[model samples]
Target: MSNPNLLVLATGGTIAGSADSATRHDYRPGQIGIDDFLARIEELGIPANLTGKQIANIGSENMTPAIWRDLHRAAVTAIGDPVCDGIIITHGTDTVEETAFVLDVTLPTSKPVVLVGAMRPATAVGYDGLRNFANAMRVASDPDAAGRGVLVVMGDRVFAARDIRKNRTRGTDAFAGFPRDAVGLVTPSALDWFGAPWRMDETARFDFSADLPDVPVLFIHAGITPEYVDRLVTTETRGIIVCGVGEGNMPDSVRERLIRLAQGGLRVVRASRLGEGLVDREPEDDANGFVAARALNPAKARILLQLLIAAGISDPAAIQSEFDRR
Candidate 1:
């Protein structure tokens, strides 16, 4: 059989950084090219025809909607190329989940798109970039990984892009668990892979950017006041995602105003600030007319709400059903 063609699209992150001589342990993105990064991987003796391209050189914090558009376009273009079997993206861990979610919804392909990143810089002692990159390449090249939509492979775990999150600030295994048993995990070595089986069909394929509105997510911290929600609602944002307290609970005062906005026809979604557990809908809270985000984080929830609104899905039952479908 011919070798699988894997496209390594490099978006600057700690994984692609190199130590700068001027500063002790200082790292810079885009300082190293994708070709050089792959050269380090060749030492592992994995047999795959690899090609590289540098799409950006900044940390993922700098990633914007425009950047997502560009990345989506790149993946779409590559999928059309006969030589390209799959695509692997090396990105910063900061916002990898968000980018992956966007691609998972937008990219119209069954080809594997594995996103990999490192919590520690390439210069750190026992940095995890090389191993993560190798494992991601292995996952991307696997025929079994196809038709799963966008996936994230880090610290040897495989997650569906829509459900993954950067749960830890500094850890090799930052992405873990799911609100539901929708996807599975991979072993430490790329030689073995396991998880809940996944299959994406036409119904699951969503037009990512079709009617996405400019929605901003606001996380409610301790001591949050009504003014915060008032400002967001008044800002004329097409949609708003409230990262509510445990179990998706919001302050009664804040909740009241959010309901007012919803009544006015503004899109509002309530998501959990806590990592795990489902958002419970209170009978009294149901009058707010806002939708519960279920298992999605504030950011991922925002992405979905934006797309759903853009798709003109306003019914509470339909939105809830869509979340359940995924």
Candidate 2:
């Protein structure tokens, strides 16, 4: 697949950042347009035929569900197009994990869909975006990259979208595949895989025809009062994910309120606040009609929960099974 046709979707992040001078650390992100970004890649001596499109120019912190929907649609179109061999997304590191997870679960495509970001501004003396961008092209063009789900290539490793998380504010090695490591690694000249193809959710793809239901993530803290929990929740809310402490435990007061809410036909999931580890289903979860997040972080769990509700699967047990598979 030499000189493969790749669709590069740009949703501004640090990779497009620019500063007053090459050494100046302060800068504005998403300043470079997709046209200019593709030109820079051409300077790297890569053989791929790249086509660029700008979906949005905001920082990933301001990433919205609307942009996500557009991005997914674009990927699906690219997948079905015989001219496009694969898809690449240039995004901010802050919320790249969320965007990737949304596409991974919703867009079902065997063509490679790779997301890449840079920690330093494009004008920085040691700009890493160019290298990372080149690496993304290499991974996408690799024949073995097909059917590996969506991938996040950063710090020279390829991470499946299911477990990618940004752990650092600055630096090239800013992400980790928590509870799981990179499925493969890539460079400008080579691509390597650690194991056989592992598609976590081979049989499920979320429907995107309608607006995704908003599922809020509730942070559980010590000494939280029942009034605090009640004030934030309302009857119209469809689902909630509790980012609890240590194995997803919350204060008794908050837990009781959540249980009551769950019994009233609201979907609830418990996820850990800590960086690493899984939230297993406790003894009373089934009785209370609550679901454990399993291996997903709070942000990712919220996405999965939203898609579940949008698909009209309200049973907690059924949602739990999705948490198990996806």
Choose the strongest candidate by TM-score: 2
TM-score of 2: 0.96
lDDT of 2 by residue, 1-326 (tens): 35899999999999999999998878999999999989888987899899999999878999988899889888988988988888999999999999999888887657889999999989998899998999899988875787788999998999999988888887788899977888888899999998877663253387764476767788878777778767767766899899999998898888899999999988989998888859999999989899999999999998999888988999999999999986
Would you estimate the TM-scores of all the predictions?
0.90, 0.96
Q: How many backbone clashes does every candidate have?
A: 1, 0
Single out the weakest 10-residue window by summed lDDT for candidate 2.
200-209
RMSD of every candidate to native, in Å, equals 2.6, 1.6
What lDDT does the true structure give each of the candidates? 0.77, 0.88
For model 2, the local distance difference test gives 0.88
The number of the candidate with the highest lDDT is 2
